[model samples]
Target: MKNKILVIEDDRAISELLCMNLTIAGYETVAAYDGIEAQRLLLWNEDADLAVVDIMLPGRDGFALMEDFRAKNLPVIYLTAKDDVASKVKGLKLGAEDYMVKPFEMLELLVRIEKILERTGRAKRILTIKNIQADLQSHQILKDGIPVNLKPLEYDLFILLLQNKNIALGREELLKRVWGEEYLGESRTVDVHIGQLRKKLELYDEIKTIPKLGYRLED
Candidate 1:
């Protein structure tokens, strides 16, 4: 099952954008435009895994809405325009899993959300994309319900690509993530592995090569 996330923001554009991206990232999202609406949703819903809240809301700010989220046992990440140290400290003290000042990168937010979900033991073990399914716990990849043999490094690289699907990752970043910082490998190594992955997984169309950047695994 996809992990369910709640987005509590007054800005309609931002809220819609977040929900769209979250959906593309294989998560189920529920959006509430105000704290009052969020509280109403929480009262009716009992299975929200996490929440992304904006500080300034029409009826009750994010800080004020924490009690409702707490009552639901939902972890929260504050995504607000408020950048003051006081606000940050208060949000942390209020038990937010993370805080991000607005103009935040969507990729960073997605990564942070994934990390918090994993840390809180709310992450889904199996990740599905089309006919492929990856067992995160067992580190196994299956295509069409059959096990697909993958080398150790290939598996790690695949997981990285899968987790950050549709996001372009540079060769240096891929090298650092998959091969480690001390590996001292050339960028060509990434290309080789990517080629192997594309051939092995038969993902020629899905795994895109970004010009001047590196690669992006399209969902």
Candidate 2:
């Protein structure tokens, strides 16, 4: 099956061009004009293997969209005109597997896209957290035989925390690792997700917030 790619660019010219190039490169392409539309498509389309996003857009913008993708463990490449050093650094820091400046060679984009898809396709097996078990492959969370259905981001955040259990993960780290660096939203996003996970896991007091530092899962 051809890998599906979502392209979020408000400019019709750019969007259509990307779609054409992607299709010719043997990838199934879906185009959305803005962040809101892109998000709508993502919720409805479960087959998207990768996302190529532009930094500027109406409504949510690329950074915000990338945050949503990160929570779902989706691999992304930023295709944007925001080519400053800071922008590239931010995108990479936020877990974007790759960043391609706008007006880039189509061949380069194709290569980068393939590389990212290959990397993300690698196995993500079960992750054990204290007494809880998270099977990332099946998106299942279990505690002593009981099942827990976590919101997508909650699941990702829980796994990240569990993987680094007992170690302090600063707010910036969580934001960059889980939310993506281009995410300009409040840092409290991490706290909110953590709170939700703690409540759902019924592991009260398991996640500790260090004053002026960050969060950690107690061993």
Candidate 3:
């Protein structure tokens, strides 16, 4: 299952950007523009693994929302513009595992979140299936502990296949999901990438070509 992240930020653009990057990183995400909405989301949907909260909110402040997350034992990382020593001290004092001021690098934030999740024993950065070692954090793939270098498109295809293991995914559907539908390319583009993956990573046995369909990566 993918780790789900709850983002509570009032700024529409920032919230959307965070969610987009989180999705690209292979994590499920939900967003609430205000603390009130955040609370509602948390109360009803209790499976959120972590939260990225902004201190300045419309209805409920991020500090107050921490109480709710604490009650549910959810890990949190404060992502706010309040870069003061006092505010940082307060957030850390309130049991936040990590705090990042605004204008933070997305990659650093992801690394910080990964470490917190790892410390809490709530996440595994390395995804394994058969001999495939997919390091989600590093975006690296390995076969039988040996490095497998893949082009960006090839890597994306490989990850998509693993994400839908044992399920048939049509080439068109693969193109839509991995390469985006607006991308001007034929379904044969997927076939070419799959061939490269099978050849380079020795995934020929696992990735089965579906007749009249797309493909399925069997475990």
Candidate 4:
């Protein structure tokens, strides 16, 4: 099962983007646009493995929300546009696992999440999507009980597609996650690896390209 993450941000665009990206990273997400909605989700709707909270919120604010989250003994990360040293210090002092300023890179966010989960012993290793079994611990994949040998980049690309099943991923997003943000590579790099994945895995129909967009994976 994917880890469940609670996202408390008032901006709908940011919240939705976080949900989409986190889901693509194989984490289930519950988004709350305000503090009251956040409270309701925590109180009666869903349990969360971790929370990403924005310092500014409607109705109650992020710090107040942290009190309730702390009661559950849940891990928290503060994501806000606030870049002041004092705000960062206070949030860390208040027990947040990490603090990220806005306009951050998605790859960094993912790395931080993995690190926090690893520290808390909540990191996931086995991922089963459709007939594909990904054992992260071994960096191997099995399709329908048969091993599928993939080149290093092919395996990385395949995992990203499987995790974001049904969602269209752009070349930029794939590049950042798979090739690292500093890779300065061409979009064709993604295309070549994607082609390799389709041919080797027989996923011609399962993986699709969206016109003017990028690629989407179907179950």
Candidate 5:
């Protein structure tokens, strides 16, 4: 089952963008354009695994809404333009899982969300793509119900590409993520591993090499 996320933001454009991206990331999303609607959703016992909330709103503010979330044991990540230390401290003190400032990286936000869900035991354990199935908890992969042997780093790279499929990922960022930051490996290392993945999985056509970028595993 896809994890459901609630987005409570007054800005319709930002809310839509977040919902669309979250959907693309294999999540179900609900949007509340204002605090009043958010409060109503909460009162109605809307089901949500996590919430991305904006501080400023038409009705009740995020801080005030935190009480309602706490009452229901709902996890929250504050996404706001307010970058003040006091606000940050207060949001954390209010029991927010995370706090992100505006103009944030969408990829970073998606990663943070995935981490929070995993930490909270709310993330889905199995992922399926065509004939492939990945068991995240066991770190296992299967193709056509048969086990597929992969190196540890290969598994990590495969999972990363699967999670961020359809989006181009840079070689430098891939190296930093799959290999450790201190590995000091060349970008060619990524290419070699990607080649291995394609050959092993018969995904030579699905995984596209983006010129001047790196790769994108298309859905």
Candidate 6:
């Protein structure tokens, strides 16, 4: 199936150009002129594999829109005029898979889209731990036949732990792998996120903390 992409940009010219280029690149594209419209489309469209969002939008703005997308477990790329270091860091912190500054080359955009799709596609499809089943493709987690709700980062952390399974993962390794290398937060951030995941997954006893090392999921 062709990858479906949602492009949320307020500028008509830029949106049109992106839609045209993405269509040429063999993607099914949906365009939204503002954050409100973007949110509407996202809520209604079930096949959106990825989203390219501009920071400055008419209504809720990109950051707000991104939060919604994150909740839906949607991979996102930020396309915006803001090229400052602060903006980049903020977007990355918000869980964007990629960031592209404005006036970007169409070819470069294509490459970025391809890379994001490739990485997301290569992620684990299913994760089973104890009575829990995580379906990466559908972004659903079931615990003993009951659905479990996880925040975006929590889901990523859970999948990572399951992928490693019995192997002990260090704080730095988990931070880099799940939060991206550019993440400048303290290592303790991992602990907080892991705690949240444990609580959400009802696996507090299943996740073993290795004191000075990191964590391991018990088999």
In order, candidate lDDTs are 0.91, 0.80, 0.86, 0.85, 0.90, 0.83
Best model number under lDDT: 1
lDDT of 3: 0.86
TM-score of each: 0.93, 0.55, 0.62, 0.71, 0.95, 0.56
Instruction: State the weakest 10-residue window (summed lDDT) of model 2.
Output: 122-131
In model 6, what are the clashing residue pairs, if there are any?
A: none
At residue 72, candidate 5 shows an lDDT of: 79
What would the per-residue lDDT of candidate 5 be over residues 1-219, giving only the tens digit for each residue? 778899999999999999998888778898898888998888765567899999998889999999999987889999999999999999999999999999999989998998998898888889877799999999999999899999999999999998887778999889988897898768998999999999888888888999999999888
Query: What lDDT tens digits, residue by residue, belong to model 2 across residues 131-206?
Result: 7888866889998868988988788788767655565678887888788879999889888888888898977788
lDDT of 3 at 61: 94
lDDT of 6 by residue, 6-106 (tens): 99999999999888767655567999999889989998878788999999999888988878998888999999999999999999999999888988977
Q: What TM-score should be assigned to candidate 6?
A: 0.56
Rate residue 175 of model 2 by lDDT: 86
CA lDDT for candidate 5: 0.90
- Which of 3 and 4 is the better model by TM-score? 4
**Between 2 and 3, whose lDDT is larger?**
3
RMSD (CA, Å), each prediction: 1.6, 15.5, 10.4, 3.9, 1.4, 13.6
lDDT of 1: 0.91
Model 6 misses residue 128 by how many Å? Answer: 34
Q: Please say which candidate is ahead in TM-score: 3 or 5.
A: 5
Rank by lDDT, highest first.
Answer: 1, 5, 3, 4, 6, 2
